[model samples]
Target: MSNEFALNAEARSDLGKGASRRLRRNANLVPAVIYGGDKAPQSISLLAKDLAKLLENEAAFSHVLSLNVAGANETVLIKALQRHPAKGYVLHADFQRVVAGQKLQAHVPLHFMNQETAAGVKTGGGEISHTLSEVEVSCLPKDLPEFIEVDMAKVEVGQIVHLSDLKLPKGVELVALAHGSDLAVANIHMPRVQAESEDTGTAAE
Candidate 1:
């Protein structure tokens, strides 16, 4: 895997809510825990500025990260993040160790292509409605993707794009679809204003 994203951290011996609060308040560090594989859970703290800069890129969430904790480098995937409700800043993070052959689940963002030029919107006077911004996929570490592409160029009005319609990369599988749920991803439909106008016209006649 490419080491495009990396973070340097210090092994944290001070654990718990109060300690984490103090670390964030006094030292501007984000407390985090790394677990998985054959190793026990490890606690670490990262520089807030460095972590914030890394998070500026959207692909970082899906990509395998190189985390250096106290001079030891480990491959990890971001599992969860806890943020301040009002400020929307990351407070705590959870990292999962990446095992070579083991399959893991990750949420990847969906990129909609040709939304303006889609058949339904360009010629049919319809608008595109997105049902999902991201999807959870299960794949090996090597097969993980940065994002899934949703093609909208050929979609017509009144047609709903479901999870089954997505073209996934090789070795990737949708977790929801595997559990027998074919969720809707997006759709092209007539605007509500147009529908309401037509309804009023019919009532007047």
Candidate 2:
């Protein structure tokens, strides 16, 4: 919510792969579409440099964005981005319109905190393994979180952090948890070498 992004775009009448290629090659424009809410999809084009600059910030992926299309303002969230396989430039972009008072689903990144100071690593000689890097959350656009934090300070070896164990922000809900899937987020466990050594000792006994 603290991070704000805005882009200026022009509505594009030309469509198809050929037109898109020309836009990118000649005009340095990136074709995009905005959909969702009660309105039909709108085809648009944005300056490639502008789009790239906006995407440079990681929070832009999760925070609600203000898009000015042909002088009309639309509140939206980045839904997807098509990138050139090797060069890694934006080929196409998709935006989902944000409807006020309606619940929306988006994937937010997870930030692991206190990994070095965790009880498992500091005293138990364990390593932290992350099973999920991001999680889908359901919340109103205004309540969307830039990222969720996973606290590992108190975690001990053999402790697994599950989706249900995450402390979500106010008014935010995990999509998987709502569907009854409490997926593992991260875990603190013995180092791989130590674990394997113990297993070998047990087998030899």
Candidate 3:
């Protein structure tokens, strides 16, 4: 994946809730902060519409961001985001500085491939249950993956794919498996209704 996420941000001098509210209402900007990596926390604001547009791409979350703050480009990653409770508009965002060769933890989305043709679903008439839609991984910035692929082609009914079952990209490591946890990532099982119907059929026979 190309590292091309760039946003234009303006440094903000104002502080407190009132200032943030004014920036949102009057300036139509989303308040944000940048911290970490030997730099003091800096308050900044970005165009609400622009930020929303940038977020439309799913890769923006895991890929490193190039934030142009007052003409200086800063390499950072999205740490957190706060949205309006009712309207779901972005209220604030947090960014953390990232340095080359330094390892960091990030949650990458999981992509289940070949689920429709999996042996469990095609032959066993089972449903695929995804226990985890995302996974946390530790890797350097260059080794970070936008998403992890979980192949389900050979999965059978009653079989579960755990954290250790996932094939990590080179240089990336699963945080859970590293700590000795083999949590389930996905599984195939018969639906409750189907199980009950089969039980009734067996009794009738």
Number of the top candidate by TM-score? 1
| Poorly placed runs, candidate 2 (over 4 Å) | 1-4, 200-205
lDDT of 2 by residue, 124-186 (tens): 999999999999999998899999999999999999999998999999999999999999999
Q: Per-prediction count of colliding residue pairs?
A: 0, 0, 0
Which candidate, 1 or 2, has the higher lDDT?
1
| Model 3, C-alpha of 193: deviation from truth (Å) | 1.7
Candidate 3 residue lDDT tens string, 163-192: 888888999999888999999999999988
What is the Cα-based TM-score of model 2? 0.94
Report the lDDT tens digits of candidate 1 across residue range 1-205. Answer: 4555899999999889999999999999999999999999999999999998989999999999999998999899999999999998899999999999999999999999999999999999999999999999999999999999999999999999999999999999999999999999999999999999999999999
How far out, in Å, is residue 165 in model 1? 0.4
What's the residue-level lDDT of 84 in candidate 3? Answer: 98
Positional deviation of residue 40's Cα in model 1 after best superposition, in angstroms = 0.6
Off by over 4 Å in 3: 1-4, 200-205
lDDT of each: 0.95, 0.94, 0.92
